[model samples]
Target: MNVAENEIKSVMDKYRKFAVYGLSPDPTKPSHYVPLYMRDHGWEMVGTYPKPHEANGFTIYKSLTEIPKEYRKFIDVFRASEKIPEVVDEAIALGGVEVLWLQLGIHHAAAEAKAEKAGIKVVSNRCLIIEHKKWF
Candidate 1:
C-alpha cells in the first residue's frame, strides 16, 4: 500500500534523526548518497553497515542494535526488497522505531504490514530525497 503524501510529510517532520539500514561505504551508491543528502539537509543520521566502515563521516554501526536508542526513532532502509523482512525484524526487535522508510524501488508488502502492526509507520517505494524536496 502507498503511504499518503500528508503522512509522508508528517513522518519527515516528526523524525529528524534516523538510522540508515544497509548503508554502503561506496560513495556512488544511493545507500551512500541518499543518507548524505538527508544529512546535508539537516537531518541527523547514523548508519548500519555490514562491516566497520565510514560513509562520508557519518557514524556507521555494525547493526541496528548497535545504534543508540535515541537515534532508533526512524530507519531509512536501502536494502533489497527481499531483505526487508529481516530489516523489519531487526527494527521490531530493536524497538523504539517510530517509522520504517524503504527507499525508492524498495517495497515488501509483508514486511510493511509487519512493521505497521508493530506500531511503526511504513513508507515504501519512495525516495526520501524526492519527498523532502517536494514537501519541505
Candidate 2:
C-alpha cells in the first residue's frame, strides 16, 4: 500500500474514537461539521475548544489532557498551521496519541516530524470527511 493508504488503514484499525482540537461552535466551519459527520457515521468524537462548551451535542474540553485517554488516541486538529507545534507538544505530553491528523489547509512540517518521531502517525493537509468517504 501507498503511505497514505497505510496510514489510513493503521488509524482505522486502531482507533474508533477521536478528539478534535480547536473545534468551533459555528456549523458552517469544517471544524464543527466534520466531527459531527464522523459522529453520525459512527466515529465517537470529543473535542477540545478554547472554553468549555457544547458543539452539536459533543462535549468540548479545555485541553487535550482533559479528554479521556481512549479518545486521545486519535486527534484531528483544526488549529492554524503555526499553532500546530503547541498542539504537538500537548499531544506528546498527554501521551497515548496514535494519530495526529491535521485538517485540510493545515500543515506543519516540524510539528509533523516531531509527532512522527514520538511514534505518532501524522497525516497533514487532508480533509477527514473526504478521506473517510474515499476509503470507506
Candidate 3:
C-alpha cells in the first residue's frame, strides 16, 4: 500500500487491536511492558507466544495461526530481526492483518517488503507505545 512517511502517524492512529508476537510474561521486558502500556491506554491485545499463558487478561495464542481471524488486524512483532519474515508470512497467511510492526531496534527489509506487498502497512524500528503517546 506504500505508506508515506507523512502518513505513518495517521496509520498508527487507526490501529487499536493488535496481536503481539513474542510477548513475554516478565514485567520488566519491553515485549511485556509496551503492550501493557497500550492495553492500559484502551488498546485490545492478544499474545502469540510459544507457551499458553495470559498476559494482563489477554489470551496467548500458541501461534499466529491460532489467533482469531477477526483479531488479526495488527501484529506487533518482538522477535529477532531474522525471525521477522516468518512472522510476516504468518500475518499474510492470516489474511486480515492491516499492519505489521517491528519493535524498536528490530527491522528486516525483506520481511517489511513482503508484508507491504501483501497490502499490510509496515512500521519498522519504532516503538508502538512511543508512537501512541505521540500521536494519541
> Could you tell me the TM-score of candidate 1?
0.95
| Ranked candidates, highest lDDT first | 1, 2, 3
lDDT of 3 by residue, 12-76 (tens): 66777778998998888999999889888888888888987767777898988888865678888
Mind giving the per-residue lDDT tens digits that candidate 2 earns over 10-101? 57656779899989999999999999888887899899888777788898889988889989998999999999999999899888998888
Clashing pairs in 3: none
> lDDT for every model?
0.88, 0.86, 0.83
* Candidate with best lDDT: 1
Better of 1 and 3 by TM-score: 1
Higher-TM-score candidate of 2 and 3: 2
Instruction: Estimate the overall C-alpha local distance difference test score of candidate 2.
Output: 0.86
How do the predictions measure up, each by TM-score? 0.95, 0.93, 0.91
Q: Best to worst by TM-score, what's the order?
A: 1, 2, 3
Model 2 steric clash pairs:
none
Write candidate 1's Cα lDDT for 1-136 as tens digits. 4467777888888888989988899999999999889888989999998898866899988888889987899889999999999998988888898888899999999999998888888888999889989999
- Once fitted onto the true fold, the runs of candidate 2 whose alpha carbons sit more than 4 angstroms away are 1-3
